[model samples]
Target: MKKTLIAAFICSLSATPALAKTEIQFWHAMGGALGEKVEDVVAGFNASQNEYQVNASYRGNYNDTMTAAIAAFRSNQQPAIVQVYEVGTATMMAAEGAIYPTYQLMEEFSKGFDQSDYLSSVTGYYADQNGNMLSMPFNSSTPVLYYNKGAFAKAGLPDRGPATWAEMEEFGQKLLDAGYACGFTTAWQSWIHLENLSARHNVPFASKENGFGGTDAELQFNGPVQVAHIEKMGEWQKAGIFSYSGRTNEGSAKFYSEECGMYTESSAGYAGINANAQFEFGVSSLPYWDNAIETPQNTIIGGATLWTLRGHDDDAYRTVAAFYDYLSDPVVQADWHQFTGYLPITYSAIKLSEEQGFYEQNPGTDTSIKQMTSVEPTENSTGLRLGNFPQIRGIIDESLESVWNGTASAQEALDRAVSRGNEQLRRFERANR
Candidate 1:
């Protein structure tokens, strides 16, 4: 009955006749304010022209959302478009019968589709072996440093966040001396510290092409550098220079609310900071080790994309592709980037933004794009593609938690995590094979 009500509501909403608008179901995980942004974009598209009517429904977060879609697909009721995180690339690819390639969808439906317009590193992570994109990159963002200007003032340090990890430690110590509650706190521990941290340092997160080219790779987190960094962070925790707020983004609220001095969060945090921060603040690229003179090769993107699933009728699939094309239009993409902190996905949109003086007016908004697209990008920092990555992230989080709680040393934590995570790798490999 609920499904019937939803279908009837969509049909009634679709009755307007400026042009014959085909209804396409879009299932996504964005909710609350972010979900409203998703709805607003769809409504704008519906109002722009009548060729397509996209009925978007709210699914949950990445893991719950993907699970729901896969179940619905088995029941022959999946939405045409599903928002999936980058980590799920390999799992979706291995499901050979389940998805339609974004590359083909663009060619068949959109009048002109150019892959060259997208940042190579961004699309490459979500593409097939032949460089054909599998999903429309949406909300792509990289990690950045978020610090409280007031806290820095109190600590008698420069208002700007540190550029290197050693400097950050020195700054943290001063904040501690000033009796600050915690010098720094971070969100998404594994993502910011272990995965992207390794990439920025040009350290391997795993062998076997970071678990992309093949899945026979074993985990390799027992390196001295990783241990040393983790150990230092652990020691800082004891000295009240660091705090473990939570395993999730709840840590973001702490830093923004002035409960902590520094935070490492997504570049997309710009919108939240703009809305909520009462103290002076600044954004900086993730700090690197001093020896990594060429550190921060690149920060990997952390967001979901629109994935076209199979089993939808041909016209429905075409409609999905058409909607994606509309979203990618230079004007629409630019508008979305301006309103939200998400990086513009297409080169044309970036240029359009620059021409409009968007970045010139808003300082630090371009820091993420500049940091990510600065270099040609080495293999170490290009991106990662591991199957069952959600589970692997959980494993890493557990290990990091162990370090924070003093239940184990940093080296021991990583060794055990590698052992457990490699077991997961083996499972994914066998299942895919």
Candidate 2:
């Protein structure tokens, strides 16, 4: 009887399961198709390992996610990771004690991380003054031209996109003459027309190297080049060659609906435009000012990156680092890039895509990569690292809306934006200091 009871106890002990895997929460802003891709990436990671499980929560858009994460952190319930848009870089950088630098985390936990493998143009935007990466470059992208090939063919315009602003204007005029609703429209007017325009022209968007040098930097976007460009856009609006779509990617609908022949938007616009457009379309490099004194420089990055928040356990940090390393795999990076139209963040990923002939098979898909990496990034072209940039973008949007609606001239409107933007910068400087 004693031997039978001992055998039963041994059997029960052996049948017990092991402990659950450590859970790591990731709060992000991606939604829709992009959100699905995020889930796939996380699932792949979870399947590849048994020690950690990442739970991804869609917190809303970029602004909303940032706001939510900030609230969560203050309440000591922050996620292990948060994805913040480029506009929030300065804000994140300012939150020194609340976040973990990705470089240190990678070095301490990701045994295979190679900082040198990352593309400079993509990493530079999120790096410190000494070039140490502060966040993982998850979905870096730049503005590009998305045009309706069918509309261009109907207008007797070049099937390929225009290379210069003058060419773009001429194309717009021809498209309008051919009975299109409008020649062109844009999605992110402030980003595409002003911020990137200044960078592409190697002109200063703000003092102190576009605010990368210091918080004391003031707005310098109201200069002659910017004024001339805005004036030209206004002229196009008046001539019916350009239509003013509502702010915040509202113009994408206009282009996809074939109301406009051309659109300047984030290269990530590919997925949505491809999904919606009935007519054939092509992606191309952003048009530049051909008459500028200096040749057009590289455009700046616009997408968000993943940031590791502080206060997590060592185990969670290690898991977060492992996930970061997983995300940096060449195959994973290339798949994400091709799937979403974001630039490949790592050189290995770009080379892998080339090895697979992804670019050749899909014409014009490499437009964003070429536009970003063709030239060495100058100080002006590296990127804007301004604080309170979201608010500044709002101010610029409001001011430019007045310009588009003929309530004010471009120069007058831009002057007002600069004046208003400078005050915001001052506030950020004070708060951060």
Q: Pick the candidate with the highest lDDT.
A: 2
Q: Model 1, residue 216: displacement in angstroms?
A: 2.1
Error of 1 at 275 (Å): 1.3
Q: Per-model C-alpha lDDT, please?
A: 0.84, 0.92
Question: Any runs in candidate 1 off by more than 4 Å, and if so which?
Answer: 1-20
Clash pairs, candidate 1, are: none
Best by TM-score: 2
Q: Which pairs of residues have clashing backbones in candidate 2?
A: none
* lDDT per residue (tens digit) for residues 1-433 in model 1: 9999999998888884544668988889888777888999899888887667899999888888899999999999888889998878778888878998899888887787889998887887788778889889988888898888888998899878899888888988888788777888988888888878887887788886576677687777668767888998899888777888888788877787777788888888788887888987888888888775464578788888888998877778778877887888999899888877788899899999999999998877888888889877666676787877888889989988999999999999999999998889889999989
TM-score of each: 0.93, 0.96
* Residue 39 local lDDT, model 2: 97
Cα displacement (angstroms), candidate 2, residue 356, comes to 1.3
lDDT of 2 by residue, 1-433 (tens): 9999999998778764464688899999999999999999999999998999999999999999999999999999999999999999999999999989999999898899889999999999999999999999999889999999999999998779999999988999999899998988998899999999999999999999998899999999999999999999988998988899977899988897889999998999898888899989998899888888456799998989999999999999999999999999999999999999999999999999999999999888999999998999999998989989999999999998888889999999999999999999999999999
